[model samples]
Target: MLKMFISGSIANNTIPDEVIKSVDVSMDKNYVILVGDAKGVDKNIQDLLKINNYSNVNIYHIGNKPRNLADKNWKQFKVIIDESNPKLFKDGKFTRSAQMIKDKRMVSEADFGLVIWQDVSTNRFGNVQVSKGSLNNIYNLLKMGKPVGLYFVPKPDEGIIKLTDLTYFENGVISNMVNVKTKQYYYEMKSEYEKVETQKKHDKKSQGEQLKFF
Candidate 1:
């Protein structure tokens, strides 16, 4: 059975109908859904799974127990963190590093990923900023040679649209047409984006040298 890793931004408390429809399609296909236990998209997805009475689901977490599980009967894949890593623990609580460990495991186990993204702000570079965790999940899956389908929630009132559905890209590089192909997994986008950024830096350095010689 195909294993699908699904994650989204914590900022988006509600899942758009379009995204839900896609999940339903996955369910119809009997794909094993792999999800996290956090609130927002994770919890929403879990609730959907429970409503459908779907049992082929695995909840990934970083502790003896998950923070939240919509269906208690669903299997839990506990990610044990090393006690020796100080960064893994903070103030008697598991840190983001610990959560990332769980995320990485999900990326490794799944054949592909689905990300629900909402732009939080725009950076100084005119690039749209989104939840790091969601982006990390996408990047990790892409790096692992697994494609990811991205759905963008432009506004709370407006439902999600496939990233390709948008008229313009968000990041100017990673989210562009060439990097993330239409209706396909994000194949080699990370490496390609990096190459473009590197070239930009090289061009700037060469221009600086030319100015010095003048």
Candidate 2:
């Protein structure tokens, strides 16, 4: 049973239909879904899970007090504050830092990440810019050798996302070409992931040398 961490940007109100179908298929395979109690995407996903009666879903919230508790029955993982860390606690109470700790732990515990993403220079939800944080989690999951099934929805009329999807290691093998639009998982792109990783390492090294020369 694959434990899938399902997360996305709060700025997204229009989630793609195909993405919903993909979640349906994943649930059919009994993949346990771990989601957070956030306002936009997370809340929407939970609404669908309730409508479909997906009982295997688990939720993580900032602290013992969840901002979104749509279901009272589902098990909630309270990522309590690191009391020993003064930065995380103010006046002996949990602070906003607990949210980030919860986010990191979600990625670490998952076997796979089913993420819905859209690229933008700045995505503001109310007043918070969230896309970069989601991007960071995706990269961390890739670095951990976990498969991230990314369902990317480009902004209307936009060409493509700027941040290229980093591919994971795949055994050299060939198969029929499917998923032409490339809206599905990127690893299906004919062994393209490893090549991207190689380029990224080279780029990093180049930057380091340039910095050293300064």
The most accurate candidate by TM-score is 1
Candidate 1, residues 54-149, lDDT tens digits: the string is: 999999998788888988898888888986778998778888778888999999999988888753545579865546677668677765678777
Query: What does the lDDT read for residue 126 in candidate 1?
Result: 81
lDDT of 2 at 68: 82
Model 1's alpha-carbon lDDT is 0.75
Question: What C-alpha lDDT do the candidate models reach, one value each?
Answer: 0.75, 0.66
lDDT of 1 at 190: 48
Which window of 10 residues has the lowest lDDT sum in candidate 1? 177-186
What is the per-residue lDDT of model 2 for residues 152-194, given as tens digits with 9 covering 90 to 100?
5553232212222343222110012212222233333324656
TM-scores for the candidates: 0.71, 0.65
What global local distance difference test value does model 2 have? 0.66
Question: After best superposition, candidate 1 residue 77: deviation in angstroms?
Answer: 0.6
